[model samples]
Target chain A: MSDVSLKSMDDVYPQSAGGEVRDYFQLLKPRVMSLVVFTSFVGLMLAPGTLHPFLGFVAILAIAVGAGASGALNMWYDADIDGQMQRTAARPIPRGRVSKDEALALGVVLSCFSVLVLGLATNWLAAGLLALTIGFYLFVYTMWLKRRTPQNIVIGGAAGSFPPMIGWAAVTGSVSLESVVLFLIIFLWTPPHFWALALYRCRDYSRVGVPMLPVVKGPDSTRTHILVYSFILVAFSLAPVALGFGGVAYLIMSGLLGAGFLYLAYLVFVHRVGVEADGHAKRLFLFSIFYLFALYLVLLLEAMVPGMMVPTGFEFKV
Target chain B: MEEEDLKKRKKRSIAIGLMLVGFAILFYAITIIRLGGDVFNRPL
Candidate 1:
């Protein structure tokens, strides 16, 4: 064969440049999955009853897999919009590393596997909640609310908030007020956390037509909403203390951390129409992550060490 | 096409095989734990 013909054949049958395991792992949104795993671990550890160590490991693995499945499904559905945005354009599906059909198949298979294994390993209640979380993220948040309304993250945050409750149910076999409080803490924290990012990434959301708060409602209104949610989040973070689950350490930590969170939100609200404004929003966004993590960490520590959780001499009343 | 690409594909295949084997072993362990003493006490 001529060199020209061989070169043409090589061009037609290109060498294998395909996805690696890392690309598939990226489909799982590992950072978000890590947060889910941590919160759920706190839930499992804090519950009144004990789970066998092996079964606990299984439960957490299932929950983490369930979170990853939902993330893959979200990426599959959002690939089109993701391609249009600077932040998400590098995702596996958007970058052509993984096909949409492959992502969807992986998501569906893992969802079924995680739910079934969780039910077998732990209680059905935990499994059911895991299923609900995956469905809520895919159906309610990804398919419906995200495109339709600016309030997408507000209602959609419920999906992310369910992990600790599922973890609690894995051990206790039922939901309780403590788990609900944990759920509420995350639910309330999501808005300000996301809005801070939205304020700075306003152009990206607007270009892709995702209808984020800053895109639809304007930065001023979005700033106000962030401040309002920060207020509510700070107040609600104290619920564990009132509910008698959080100790003196939790109270002190929440108070100091909540004050810092609100201060950053206030700075975001005050600065407008400049790099300074975006800087404040970015700072709040980063601190908001730390705020939530520190709050949860303190709770987990208090649960782990009884000495750290000194009684506040406060009692719950109707 | 290239030597590097061929090596990557081989590594990926091995990783997948290991994952499947690990999953099967995990299921076996979970079943044994869940059944507790019942596995040995089963009827012959």
Candidate 2:
């Protein structure tokens, strides 16, 4: 009846496990990948030293492949829990679209290719950081902390936070305090962000025996933790402003964004699911995504436009 | 039957695309390595 063009899977044939080209792509977790690539690109841009343009591109590509590899491996290992959780139940492996062995082989291949190419293209420091990131995410986070403790996301967040540092290393062949600040911002932001999701999805995590903070500590405590981490995140957000990387525009934008973040966290903290459940936790969860993205956008903008927002007397440009 | 053929075609195309990308990256790495050690160096 409707004239809208329908893009349906009706034309496609199902494979043995219903696997498709897209199923393999899904194994890479492209949504998480966009963030990794953006942060690492910013890192490459923000570092002090110069890199050959072609080599810089090569290094970034390696980091991206490595990031995708880790994601695939995570899905491979977490397939069991993933099947139980509503949010992940339709993932390639869980949905039987891709086999575990296929995912694992793809992950290992990408991992080796990425790390070795990065070492050949750039310095080994960047390559080593990439390898460390991949290993830590797989071994330390996915295999170790995820099922064992409530602090899974808290510590495992470091694995997600390493791209900028690796990006800086890719360019300068060394790590610097500036990259550390970027790392810390993401580190402090992760707990509150993830905890908010856990607030609503606690039952799903509980059913799977995954000790997400809310399932482990209950909702009230989780709300309080969200508020607390939001505070720390606000403080960390201002660090770049003080360091000369972030200018007046960045400072003002970060300030407003941080204030908005704190307000949402407070709203989530005060509201609870009762007779009528207001979606405060969901609001906070959504806002947290916007907050991190906006902060990074402001930083990226400031870096591109040199003197537009340069602080009073301190001159900094990329 | 046509749908099945389309699916197979798609899979083959993707596999070829992935292989091409890998080969290109490999070629780039070899070129960089052969160019006198450092990426920043001016080629002789």
Candidate 3:
């Protein structure tokens, strides 16, 4: 028997036959949603004020939905390219499970719903930021910047960075230096993280006609840029410590993790082109995920542990 | 023709089921621990 038959008769079905609900969910990119929710929740928790549990839940729900809306819109716009890339070929729009028009409509509905509900439930500031995030991700990153320039993810990263600030504003109703620091952590982290992937998957992106850095600038330049950004990320990660939001634990974690990131970038920089370079780049890319998650987790832990000696100089009053 | 489609549908269903289970584990931790919640609210 063939592998397809041995695996289960159900494996014979065409990919496009999935229903609307499942396809719609696929557009949300739930893994990305998890990161958005986690970072936003960190922002809310670290904010100076307090929110009722129910209200806090609502705010996070809205933010997550808005993130999902943006993801759907991105999928809709990138379907043409997505279909060509092995990494993205299984996505709803690319797989023909969801129509472009349907994805667009669902995105619009969720965008409005999230923003309005967030504004009404929290404050106008957070709602406005949420709306801006959707617009920036959809219009700026997806439509304008992506096809035009290799620096797309660099500037486009700002959309993803907004969540922490939005979560902060949801409670405080205004942006603060601390929230800005949180935003910077993610913003600065993006280039190195994404460029690492680009270095490994440059061919896939080029095949799909996307102007990612590795495709447009060559892998050598992309590696150098990754090293530069990784250095900057290390500096920015330490800002919370300098700003006094972090305690000893944060300092130690940031120091060790930042060194690890720098080491990976160095390896990627030194690795020979082709397979070895790709392996190093993939290693850095994977480590970058764990690095950001650990960094934020330490921040949250510092906040919860009393007498932990948070850094004590920079406090922004809103 | 219908049989082939049904088979595909079953595969999709199983994939979705596995995804939901993963999400459920994540959501359960997020909702239950209320990891980001402020102090003074112990679970009732």
Global lDDT scores for all candidate models: 0.92, 0.84, 0.85
In candidate 1, which residue ranges exceed 4 Å CA deviation? A1-17, B1-6
Candidate 3 pairs with clashing backbones: A13-B8, A244-A311
Q: Which pairs clash in the backbone of model 2?
A: none
Candidate 3: tens digits of C-alpha lDDT, residues A131-184: 999999999999999998999999999999999999999999999989999999
| Span of ten consecutive residues with least summed lDDT in model 1 chain A | A8-17
Could you give me the TM-score of model 1 versus the true structure?
0.93
Q: Write the per-residue lDDT of candidate 2 for residues A1-318, one digit (tens) a residue.
A: 133322211112122333677788899999888888888988888888887787888888888889999999999888767878899988888777777778898899999989988888878899999999999999999999999999999999999999988989988889888999999998899999999888888889999999999887888899889888899899878888777888888888888998999998888877787622238888888888888888888888777776765773433445
CAPRI category for model 1:
medium
Model 1 achieves a DockQ score of 0.59
lDDT of 1 at A309: 81
Candidate 2 has a TM-score of: 0.87
DockQ of each: 0.59, 0.28, 0.10
Ranking by DockQ: 1, 2, 3
